[model samples]
Target: MKVPAPNDDRKGGRVPRWLRILLPAVLIVVWLALAGVGGPYFGRVSEVSSNDQASYLPASADATQVANLQAKFSGSDAVPAIVVYERSSGLTKDDLAAITDDTKDIADLPGVHGDVSPPIASKDGKAAEVFVPFADDSDLDTNVAGLRDHLSTSTPDGVTSYVTGPAGFTADLVAAFGGIDGILLAVALAAVFLILVVVYRSPLLPILVLATSMFGLCVALLVVWWLAKWGAVQLNGQVQGILFILVIGAATDYSLLYVSRYREALRDEQSRWRATWIAIRGAFGPIVASAGTVIVGLLCLLFSDLNSNKALGPVASIGIVFAFLAAMTLLPSLLLAFGRAAFWPVRPKFGSEHPQVVGPHAKGLWARVAGWIRRAPRIIWVVCTIALLLGATGVLQLKADGVPQSDLILGHSDARDGQQVLADHFPGGSGSPALVVGPASELQPMADVLLNHDGVSSVAVVAKDSPSGTAPVTADGVQPVGAPGSPPPEPTTVDGDVMLQATLSDPADSDAAEATVRSLRTDLYKVDDGILVGGVTAVAIDSNDASIHDRNTIIPIVLVVILLILMLLLRAILAPVILVLSVVVSFAASLGVSAYVFDHVFGFPGADPAVPLYGFVFLVALGIDYNIFLMTRVREETQLHGTRQGILRGLAVTGGVITSAGLVLASTFAALGVIPILFLAQIAFIVAFGVLVDTLIVRSLLVPALSYDIGRAIWWPSKLWRTDAAILASDSDPERLVEEQIDAIGAGGRPSHHHEHLHQGDREHPAP
Candidate 1:
């Protein structure tokens, strides 16, 4: 335990002082330039992003196929905006006149596609509706806002108006995600800054850490934005928000590990140059291993059938890669530039006695906890396991099958309110309709089949010559709304197929409507196997199914992939398996608790099937990070001090930094709740809670206790186990040997000469 002298250079070739200073300066300038360039892309992300659910489905999905074919028949993809005008009493003549005039005026607005449908009054005479179509390529939010503005100013007295349908919902969704670029980032950064300030009690260190995180995010966004603009990847608000949080959280966590190593190194090596190298060498293994685990785990999403899920894999992986680079390159340069001043007011003095080696009386909180674990390791792990299991039982109550599209946005929604109004007075699916595509020759048969279903209120076929762009199709055949003697309009056809629109008796996003679409597809296929049923409801069904498919398929793959990674990093089978199991249990418990809270406390209708999938990915991948940090150090210590003493020393030393990292990660994820989207909010709660559980309970108590109880076998089938066993066997009394080692460490002296078998290099420069 003889401490190295300050600024000592005798053990290696000396680096030129000028080069040392120049190197850090160059790196800092390079990062600053990169950050400056990437900064503006944050506001430009929406330019290349899309939130359309139908567009994210796989090409092989029925909904995707029907959507593509329907576009062919219409010659344009138009999103329908249903305008509903209602009076509690009855619609007056003035109301009808004003609605008709409003329809005409709306037709002239920019992006309005085709002809607007004439106003149709309901049988109750209390409500009327108009169908306005917007070209898909246009700015839906801008056009929808204009339409709403026009209605707000021109609506008849006492007649309330609402714009709701695919277009309206799209607009609202866009507005909800609008906060991602500004408010969300602000909240996440503020939370992280506060936490860093509290943890470090040093302003300079927090600023350096925040710079590393921000620079990483800026560069990552730059790459992702161009990829999206070039059509190489799809970007959406959800993916964008996740990328920001992931890069910031992962980068900060990595920075914390480096800072910890640097502080520890400075105590042993006074020269900033030598200290920087020592810190980098010590932190490099765990940081790279941690980032690799998360990146590889995220890439597993490529196996997901859902396009949105697949897009997340590479997008998040890019963020992780940049986070790794910023931590390894940018952060080191910043720290090296300032040296001990980076941690001003709490600078680690050279040759200072290390805390962990200072015996029981001088032990900090983590050391005290480690002592308690050593006394009753089995009981602690068993009790913690039972508590986690009990919490996980709530998973049965989780309603992750799917939620109504109307419920996707949290809080007030004009579109949701309008949908209720439309359902109360008119055919629930007046504006949104299930589309049926089949052979042109079987158009009548298809119409008849649709008409047979109780859920179908009416059916229509695309008609090029019709004023409304579609003519009503009944059991009798296509009906002529023109002059009595005029012939019915010809149905538009594409690739030997005809398209039929079936309006349902329930809202398009309703569970009833989903069932109706499912049955319609089943019944229609009986008549013609080539027939396909799709619409808003069908899109939800397919998206949910694909998400569920991804959850089942990708979860196991992530576990297997992460396990193999752990095995490689730890070089032990049993230890890796134990770590994976601990993380999985932690995920289950987090999801279980979140499910109960979402149902009872928040009154959440339900979750997207992908919610669990995302929670699992983030919690397991990110959650395992603390364990990796702890175990790698434990393994390094075990190589010198024997398993039991090494486990204690590792826990005591790593406890503070690992806990700080967990808090930083959890808080960054919690910031996702700022966006008023249900999926993101649910993800925020689940991941934030899971990281805490893993950090406080699993990593702190469960993993360490289990490893301690298992002893050398935790490294079973590895050379370390045999080497440790031999070290233990050579000592007649293991307990006395551990005490003697602790006393030697406390006195700043080497262990007894009898224990000279330990590696000299490791003795000189221990792993962080």
Candidate 2:
């Protein structure tokens, strides 16, 4: 009985190409359907940060009050503009009237919040804050920016208005994305295109490269959307943006290894289909192995204690798998159909017997650099070790923040202007930061100490105040649930509870802001035993704690997962172990460098809490990818040549491909430096630079030297290695071997003349 290999043609003859062409199409269609059906569901779950977290705690509202408040301060639309007016002299009747007119205009704006605060002329009349709220679904930035610009240039005579608070932050976000983000995207695109063009050597090739990656990205996001809507995942806009770049850049990289080899096959065979099969067959082990390593790395995110990290891992893994699927199936089918003709005007002959050295021409400047390292591998290792050590010194200095965007409008911005006015009249906290008031007994002494804190500028004790407002109580009121005697409810009172404005010493993004929060908490715990230290900063700290806790847990889990996968793929105990170790070292080195670049070089607000975590994941996972690519060559060498000679030859053949992919990946990532969101751009640079180093320095030199040093011990008594020994004894015909793919010209455009049968079907690229 003949065993059918899905990957290869049994007789090296014609095979139906339906699955190869159609499976990817079906996946893409299914992915699109999933996205359409599931977008809103995931979107709702994603609103946790903006919804449930934003809702009040420790109280249950009656339906009426729930509806009232739901419509009132519900969603993100509440607390729009707290317009402030300032003048040296106390407010005159004219100034007050002018302020009133502006409030009317703001309140009347589309999607404007109901019940605007009356003109709050200051006690001394020199300043006043007018509260203007808006609807949750409103485009706060658009309206606020327009208003701010209008008010800045057209303040009514002596009266000046400034808008502040959440509206201001929203405006800032819009501006940041609009202004610097475009440049970053463009740079990233240019970098990716340039790298792909140089590597693939065709203008059309880079577009295909990106298209394949984009297809992967779209499918991964669709899966995430499906799972997220059903409450299986969680995401935020930042995650979306980050995933976009990661999937595209990463998928392209994964394809590079296979495609480059395919092109090489074409050059040797001269028959496009023949070379395509050869390329596909030859690349099977290394490509799958490399992908498995990446998948394992991404799966590590599943262990994230943070729901975000956990979700991120699965989503990313989907991307890798789909990309792998696309490469192995979609790419192969396309190549088979087009053949060498895809290369068009150039057939990629490169002479009958190309120079063996891969010298200075298309070989890149790195080959010369590698040659230098090969001559003095020990010295190279010493220098690199020292350099990486120095780079890593900055890791110790890394700090974490939950919300780290620079989201503040200019002095003339609507929100900023509104905020300045509010601050000048009332306290800054009067605008943002909800006061989570509870009973005196519930908070202990926290209230008293917080009242006296230097940052506390105002106090609002709503407990003793009676609500006689004819302003129509929209209160559906809280349900009198779990009441022992069902005490009759009157006007809500907690006089014993303290409502105090807790100010900060600096901007939250600054070092001092975090320090202030820390110091305040310490002082609260020291004196005010009853206080809970509750508010945005408090939530931030909790989230940060969660982030740190998750990182500590997830890293080990991910590493172990990746190691296990490597063990299976390589079928070697020692080889997989060393590969994991080398990759780990490279990851640590990359993180240290990332910290330096972001925290020291560019001086960002430290690393994004997620930044180091991503560095570890990508560096180790993708680093192993290159390791697999290089190690396959080394393994082939050992099988054909001895350890030393094989290592040298493998490096010579595969080194250029690895370096080209790295350059392209790095450049794509480096483009992030141009992104408006400072942290994201920083992340791009860090990851990009890490990829470059992984290819140019680590894989090209250090790994080869180590492989040379290891010899047969790299495989260390694996059954597969033993089986290979048996194959050596029988001297299996190289051309007759049943590979997973029919040998053909690869993406590298190589050619081959020998005939063979290629019998494979849907099993190679299954749809359902």
Candidate 3:
């Protein structure tokens, strides 16, 4: 092995020395500036985000139409907060008086809309409830906080008070999401950093890799924040958190591939400039294909009817784009600046021996695994496929219809507790009611219909002059609230339409309430097809329906898009089809396993419908990446070594880097659990587990062994398949065939024969 002179610049050719120095320096400075500008936007994401479930419903959804019509009848956009005051022994006179005073005090608050409802005592006499409406334009969380604080200090002795309803739930969701900027990012970055440190075992290299990820996130956030600010897209804590993780994980993964290539190039090329160029050229294709697949898969979300799902597409795609740019540009520049020092004690010296290429005798874990595959390719694939199928059977246990709103937050929740207390004392849907909008002429008929339903505890029609802003409606008609013989309050009418509010017999977030809403919509539409039903329960129903629709619609599109990309990438239809099928099976196994874990292991009540869709998008798109990484290298190796030997070499060489990359990505996604939101937590587990499955099993064994077993036909309809077959036929001896293939590809040196005896040993005990 010959070492080159330290000042060797022959490989740099006629390129100016100053120009090389200036290029990397400029890239570093530019990235630093962009990162500085975008860093602070992390803390400001909540400004443009809304957690209101109604806001995410598709515009064409029945709930959305009803929500739009609600403002016309009320003349104000307000979200209701239900305050429950409970005493196990029963509320005394003093407690009732105190509640009356609390309502008056709440009305004086800054964001209070119109009027606050006086405390209404339950028949059980154990609890009293007050409905407070907060103006939508005002700071809702702040107003809810003030109301809670006032009640906390002023509630009568021995009475428990809690603020829970749409507004309270919204406040809880906001608080849960508050960690996205600080804790979530810190946990994810810390996890990735620890993983990188262990993988590289170098101090400076981990820092460099993290710098690439951080800079990419900062720039991605800068662009996303502006897009959200301009109202071109919607942002939520969920989307924001995902963007941070995606950019960091993807940028780092891409960086790792580049680093591997750079180190390999450094061993062969003495000039640092030449090595950097070589590394970029080698890394550019797979990284772009990986990023493009993810971007297109994410973009497929645009077809989703749910706004949250739709918004995630472009927002996450933007993050991937920047991750690609940073990995391709900034990471390379930084690596160029550091050169051999980046790897520190383990730096690759020029002219050093490379890992033994494609042989049973190679001395590494992956090499050993490769040797095993060479011995029994068909058996390995058959057993792996059977095991994956067995694991996939657990998908039947998955309960992804949707979870109650109270279950959205994983831990303790004031809103959830209050909803229970409210349910025990009075109608379950006290504060949150199913809102119905219909023609004013059909008001009496609608009230009759509402009164006929078993699920409806009570019904009311909005009236401007009514003390509670809504008058109770009975089978007869709208009734007055003040005194007997008093005139009935006129129903508020907007463009000849009237809004009715029906309190359900069950909790607004309960599955029973959703069922009731569905039934009521069907029954109500029979009386008047123009009637629209919308509220908390309706919103949940619509969101779940859209998610299921998106899951069914987008999954196939993603498959087609990724399949085409793979075909173009591998230049072989059969190989891409096989790769896609392997990942699809892996995703199913992951979900099936996740379903069992979510049910029996963790005792999660149920999942949101979008959970599977999100899991598929990430697992399939990102999962396919490992296949791309493996198959592309196999294709490159095959051009020189024929199909059977190429699979072995590609697997051995890529095994370490791809596994490390998978760990990095899985760890980042797992960090989503820190947010205390059930949806993110579920997503975190599904993706994390799915990636490991893809890396360790599918990519490592199934795809490789299956392709190896098929031999050259995996590249059918391509010239390499025919060319490699001819080379294999020309010589019966494996060592001679390898030398002939090298000559066929126009290489300069005779192939290494140190492993010639190893090939002879394999030939003696040929693979079954």
Candidate 4:
């Protein structure tokens, strides 16, 4: 249960201290190096997405197939920007004049190409769109940001211009993230202060939690950054927000354990250092087990079919691991140096038995709930089952989709305006779907064929060229274009293939896009040799296509993981079985409720692509964590007392802490909903709902009753546990055994030796 101590050869905690500083320094140096070597920063930014599975298509072909394909897209690589003009006050002659001037101005901006539409007024003359083509397709996000900034500055009264397309979506995400950096820091500080004030009853302690968690977050972020730079793993912008939450919440959980126990040791008559060490030993096992459950749950994300989902799981797991480490080591070190004043003003007496979870009269609310369960356990089960099943109806209606970039921004955002422009004039698929790369020879005919297809709104063809002919000159400037349509020419390719560019009416990330893509996927290869489709849409479809397989694999995989962990810890097969089953029920309830809220009430554009998988992994896994906390207490108590009494005792002891943790976690996710972004908000709602289900229904009520009903069969055939000789004398006092932390500030150092001695006495015989 204890952390492995540092060796005598290294003392004064210098090793860990140096590690904390040196690690980040090494990572930053490496990141700058990679950034320097990765060609233009645009190419480097693009490289971040190059390996993402969701950013790619299904691997039905090799490099040769892809090479054979991209040769066709010569003319269309420079996707046009939709220049939107809106006059909510109604477009006047001046509006048109301003729009014309803006379009002319953009024609001269860096990277602009092709013919732009004049400001065509809406039926009500409130809107118009102009088209500006990009001179080159590289560094799309940066280019868009520049364009937006310029246009925003130059826009005149009674008119506005929105530059939107695939490029525009990327631009908006980058812009929204501008504010996110500060918000994340604020969120971390707020969560820590809140936790400290509630649990420790002091401002100083919460500040410590924040500082400790920030240290853990810094390590986690540094690692993620290193991995991102080194091509080890990738993180999306969405990942950044969730990562902040995970690191803070998880690290705070550990901080709570360490500080609370540290205070208990101080009250037990132990010196600061000794009490800190004992607290580590006492708390280490439970925290590790708790964190293990979370880690295992997050690791289940590896089984998720989506790259974003996969990336998120490991990122969260890594944060939790680092937090766990800080809890065991760094936190103990600081608390050892802190002492009795860590809990000031309202100290619970040590060496004196406080009230147990079940009071003498058994008058508390928890006892009453236990009595109801014991009186009609089966009926309670049925009622819970019915309620859960009803909640699960929402899950059955679960809907999911890939979201557009504009979906995240707040109102009146230029990015959203751009998206609206693109949506109105161009097909949504002009931006994100995977491309079907063919040859220049294939492109002209393919565009012709694609333009005629059902989902297709337009097509542009390109061919390969090599010092082929005089480049066509335009007002935009003469740069490069593949030869006119003989298998869209590539700098390097044979005569058989060309690129076909097609745009769809559906949003690049929507189900409609997926459906049309499904149709295209079937017809694409049939046309000729060296034909392929690849793009963001292509990848999203692949992700959606893989959902069935992914879920199939994940269900059994998660079940097995849970079963094994529970069996090892409980030494009983049946207990783990029920535990897993109960968790499954809670998970179903989470999904059902989310489905109703997401699909019916709020009518979200779509559930996050990774929601189902995350829900399963988090709910089932964390659900078991509560089961472990409650059941372990119950089992320990049951060994001495009867089953019903043990149930009441265990519930009384662990319920409050479990509820608090759940509330924190749920609140964190709920906070995501407040973010204007549709995808993040939906993800937040579902996760919060899942956590609530796990903590309230599954953990507090169902687990204890189920344990009682199962009887000795719960630990069947495990004679080792049945023997009183094997286990410690049961004492059901999780709260009293560890001190309830009360922090006070502005003292020279720790509490006096007399109080320290009393705290030490509490540690030796923890029941008091």
Q: Pick the candidate with the highest TM-score.
A: 1
Q: Cα lDDT of model 4 overall? A: 0.60
Q: After superposition, how far is residue 157 of candidate 3 from its true place, in Å?
A: 1.4
- Per-residue lDDT tens digits for candidate 3, residues 322-355, read 9999999999999899999999978989877676
Candidates' TM-scores?
0.95, 0.75, 0.94, 0.76
Report the candidate with higher TM-score, 3 versus 4: 3
- Over the stretch 296-409, how does candidate 2's per-residue lDDT look in tens digits? 777777655455566667766776777787677656655566665555555566224333332222144444654564456577666765666676676676665554323222
Could you give candidate 4's per-residue lDDT for residues 464-497 as a string of tens digits?
Answer: 3533212322223233555455332233333554
As a whole number from 0 to 100, the lDDT of residue 750 in candidate 2 is 33
Candidate 4, residue 123: the lDDT equals 60
lDDT of 4 at 321: 84
Predict model 2's lDDT versus the native. Answer: 0.57
RMSD of 1: 3.1
lDDT of 1: 0.88
In TM-score terms, candidate 2 sits at 0.75
Better of 2 and 4 by lDDT: 4
True lDDT of residue 449, candidate 4: 53
Question: What is the lDDT of every predicted structure here?
Answer: 0.88, 0.57, 0.88, 0.60
